[model samples]
Target: MLAMSSNPDSPRVLICDDDAEIREGLVQVFERAGFTAYAAPDVAAMERTLAAKGADLIVMDLMMPGEDGLSATKRLSGKGAPPIIMLSALGDDADRIVGLEIGADDYLAKPCNPRELVARARAVLRRGKDADQPAKSDSVRFAGFRLDVARRELHDPDGVVMPLSAGEFRLLRAFVERPQRVLSREQLLDYAFDNDSEVFDRAVDVQVSRLRKKLERPGIEVIRTVRGEGYLFAVKPTS
Candidate 1:
């Protein structure tokens, strides 16, 4: 049996790929796995479908005919965007890093195992829902930024909301929860991902890099690399 999310309802997923066979196959795979799956031929169709009926997550192909997956990924990941799992034929570290950098919650090389894909989808959806659940009125403040833990929101000093993926939110949570403490790659992974997800050390590095780009500013080094030790959250947060 496929893994299920904590919510009883099956999550909705949209697969955007140019290949008809591949798209249809993935749609069947997700449906059999108990997801409400939809298929789109390209970014345009994906946008149209989403406009009509939003999905909980997206499974996008990296190399499409019109607006490649990277661009679409960037456009789709923002303050209200659904989680995305990118599928790419190019199975290089650089390619995966780019996808992660652009806010894809997960990355799977093309021709991936359907079972693994289902597992990844479940993991991402679970994390996203967890992040959205509001806790008590608790917020963390540091370096002119505010992290509303309950609402899973990060806001700039100007009160503008910044977009964050589930993985990014977890990493930042680990940092803010333990300011000035250096956490090893293993520890960061432990904090950021559930046991069901198989993420490597290099993947952690890519996530930190992307998080830095989002939070870093002049004289505001939120996260610092501790050379061989690991990474340290430089700013001290106040509750």
Candidate 2:
């Protein structure tokens, strides 16, 4: 049976999954973890619920009947919506990278431990709330790619917007801010995650690889790995 929590102070979480059993199971987990959880069977229901009552976080499944998670995630991201954690039955680096590129805050493979999901939810919520604060203007432009720190957005040379997850944006920001500097993994994590993110070192590598792919273009190589050192933003970015 699906369980709902009635705590006003609890964060509101909306889970969108096609499987009834999985939906109910996640709802029970979230409720047990002190969140006011709601479940939707698909994207349509998820949208309706969000339109009626806003959500603090969204747990979305990757595969759905009509609109897949990537499409829904892109739509939500374009609107600057709430944080989202994508769950997928396919546990692969490519899937996780794609989810993040579409603006998911986190990605977890299905059959995930409920406790770990709770921890990720808490961490993502913490970062989301922190990001909601106003900040100073900071932007870096190089090779036609612009990193807008204030907006946490990336714009291509053609002025097209490229969606980036929180971690991806932050990592790129760290690089552009310190162009031509070789930063170790520890330094990168400190700058990007602020030591508060749940991501680890190998995950940092994955994010870098993904960001590099986005920033790469003809005759322009933005990032380079130093064998024993770390990574360097090879170009001199302009503010």
Candidate 3:
């Protein structure tokens, strides 16, 4: 089932939850916050709504009947996918890290304050908008590789395109932008994710590790870990 509110000028948000009351309540909350909100009973209905009427953001629940939110989120990971804020009863640090690693932009535990959710949505949307703005340079080159900021693509020295997840891309971009400098996990979180995001330092480590694997080559270290400090991008980037 899908319920929609009409507001052509407002940002569109799709709320996908199994609980009817929670779904409708979210729709109303987003509506009051100036979003053109839509409610979907599950991931399938959410997909239907997305195909029929594109959304700016998606509020997804972790547990559902057919497809769980984590699986759906992993399927939705890619360029142009709408930002997702995951809601789950499993509120442990491990669960949140898994959600983020899979692709959710933000994770909120169940029974969260409606106002806080709205605030987080606005912050995520703002980050998206900021990312859409024109960069001073179209791309940056580092360690014989090129990062196309606008296209969100990375090409190796051989011109082969390497696949990067949303989190990996952001973390890489932050490193390249501030190459040759040791950046603390806290700083990386601010640069790579929403400043208010509840992501832990461990999540940053995980993303950095994944990024290092992609940028890996024999005998060349691009990112380095500084004991008792943080990580540093070993090479300087050229615009």
Candidate 4:
């Protein structure tokens, strides 16, 4: 459930689109919906705005005059930037798949319904809000992957502590605390990031894979697929 703003303030949205008309229209739509919106017509402005301050969400266009949204999305993935909803003229599944692959949380075709856009925004944010929570502790060590919340770190038998991005830490923590529970993608996103994204379940899978690689246990047995279900932390955790 979305919470009422403490002071009736609006969310801050950053809009990056080469199309001036589209950018302005989205700004108007979000503003009318009680969001403070900022627009950037190109990638350069997008960078500046993103670096200047964090935003609640970023609305970006796929095709641009300069570097495309796909490339920008890659950079955002590396930096773990704000949750994004991409606007693309391309309606192909491959394009959408690529967007998801690179970490664009949501993808919307151009000329979408304003009402739907707002709903998407809220839904994404609702997920984001769920991330603020930390899962209950059950103490897990699978193969060689170990998560210790008191220290906020994961370690191998070699004592090498892998660095965790905030999101990675939370996701891994959730699994460690609930080993063997086949948590759904939506559940993991909410667990790891405070319920803030419409991020694809695949993104969660990718993050888990990345964590698994870092842990590097035999057969990569830490995280296992349950098919039809989401994923499970394979080892039974202890106190």
User: Residue-pair clashes per candidate, as listed?
Assistant: 0, 0, 0, 13
Largest TM-score belongs to which candidate? Answer: 3
Q: What is the C-alpha RMSD of each candidate to the true structure, in Å?
A: 4.0, 3.7, 1.6, 5.8
Off by over 4 Å in 2: 1-9, 74-79, 92-98, 132-146, 156-161, 186-190, 193-206, 213-220, 236-239
Candidate 4, residue 234: lDDT: 79
- All candidates' TM-scores? 0.88, 0.75, 0.93, 0.72
The positional error of residue 214 in candidate 1, measured at the CA in angstroms, is 3.0
Give a tens-digit lDDT track for model 2, residues 1-239. Answer: 23467898899999999999999999999998899998899999898888887789999999999998889997887466778899999887777767776678788988898998998899888876665444333776888887776787789999998877676766776787677989998898777765644445666787899889988899877899998889999998877
**Best-fitting candidate, measured by lDDT?**
3
Per-residue accuracy of model 4 over 23-52 as CA lDDT, tens digit each: 788888888888878888887888787687
Quality of model 1 by C-alpha lDDT: 0.83
Worst lDDT run of 10 residues, candidate 3, spans 127-136
lDDT of 3 by residue, 17-113 (tens): 9999998889889988899999898888899989999999999999999999999998887656788999999999999989988878889998899
Of models 1 and 3, which has the larger lDDT? 3
lDDT at position 41, candidate 2: 90
Runs off by more than 4 Å, candidate 1? 1-8, 135-137, 195-198
Rank candidates by TM-score, best first. Answer: 3, 1, 2, 4
